[model samples]
Target: MKAPYIFNIQKFSVHDGPGIRTTIFFKGCPIRCLWCHNPESQKYNQEVMLTSEGEEEIVGQHYTIEQIVKKVQSDQIFYDQSGGGVTFSGGEVMTQPIDYIVELASRIKRLGISLMIDTCGVAPVENYQKILPYADGFLYDLKFINSQDHFKYVGKDNSLVKDNLKFISDNGGAIYLRLILLKGINDSMDTMEKTVEWLKENNIKISEIDLLPYHDFGRDKYNRLGRKCTQNFEVPDEQHVLNIKYYLQQEGYNVKIGG
Candidate 1:
């Protein structure tokens, strides 16, 4: 199989999964979320971005499965110590070829390493099915419950995302639902209620709901990539995050403020 484009391999990433993890950031994403922080990761092919010094710099490179697995294996000692593993993050790791992901995941599993796919859940059901056998679990994003709101903010309809989530649930896939709580974007009480309703209606049992507070940390990346930073949403305050967490707990759902 051809190698997949990758933008980054972040080591010692604590927030990507259970323990200290190595995050493999794949390139390309179908949905153009307005609040996306990794603008350099949105494209599949190699691209150039401006550096802080105002010099052009390349952003992506292709990596073979063997090469990636070897790199991840170097961190085996850490994984064994902390229950950490490798997290395939994005530009939607699902956008890569399913066969490639399956192969890489197989290798990781063979090495006794846990594998987690951080996805936007906007891919086809078959993609999920093909990857399910290899992945230990998923760090799935749930941006919006209402389709229109999702379209308005994410530049795509929520149908595929919702359907894929339901599919995962039906298949008894382990899921950690991540909701980016952006003030005035997707943090409305109504949205939260709808999400709770949908989960109950579908009988989806997630490990936990991680409420990621929206921040402008990626704003500089947009500028560096020469992309327009159109995000105008404010980051939710600490109290707001706590309130949402409390509300979700009240609804009988396990919730955490951050990953």
Candidate 2:
């Protein structure tokens, strides 16, 4: 397989996963979440961004598996010392060519580096199965449990996402749940309760649940790309975020404020 389209290669990202890591931000996503921070990565094709300096800059670039491996290998020392490795993030990493992803993952595994796929869990179960062997684990995003709320907020149903999560869990795949806390959007008591209930019902055992507070940091990117920011959700305060964390903890789940 050839190189896939990538919007960015972020190095020394402490939030993506364990230790210090290099995050490959793949271009394109299936769902249009209201609170997406990297809007530039949503489109599959290359796009031009108008910079503040009146210059047109391309948003996506392609890199072969070998090229990406080389870039990731550069951080070998850090990974060896810190237990960190390569993380394939998005737009939605699964949105890329599955063949290319599997090839890339295989190469990463061959290098003996930890591999983590940060996904929204919107892809098919087969896609997850293909790469599961190469991946050390998954950073699965759980937006909304209710189908109607999920579609209204993320423009997609939750059935596939739920099914994928269950499949991974049942197969003994390591999962770390990531939930974006949007104020008055997906932060209600009902949502939290349902999320806990769903996890329990599916018998999914996750290492940790990361509660990511919603932020408008991507608003500027939307403007630079000449795209409309349709969602105006507010970020949850520290107390509210802690409260939800506490709730999850009370339910016997290990929860953290941020990833």
Residue range 1-259, candidate 2, lDDT tens digits: 5566899999999999889999999999999997788888899999999887869999899887778999999999999999999999998988678999999899889989999999999997889999889988899998988899889988989999999999999888889999998888889878899888889987998888999998788788888899998668888888988889899999998888888
Clashing pairs in 2: none
What 10-residue stretch in candidate 2 is worst by lDDT? 1-10
Residue-level lDDT for 172 in candidate 1: 78
User: For residue 204, what is the lDDT in candidate 2?
Assistant: 90
lDDT of model number 2: 0.89
The CA lDDT of each predicted structure is 0.89, 0.89
Estimate TM-scores for all models.
Answer: 0.97, 0.97
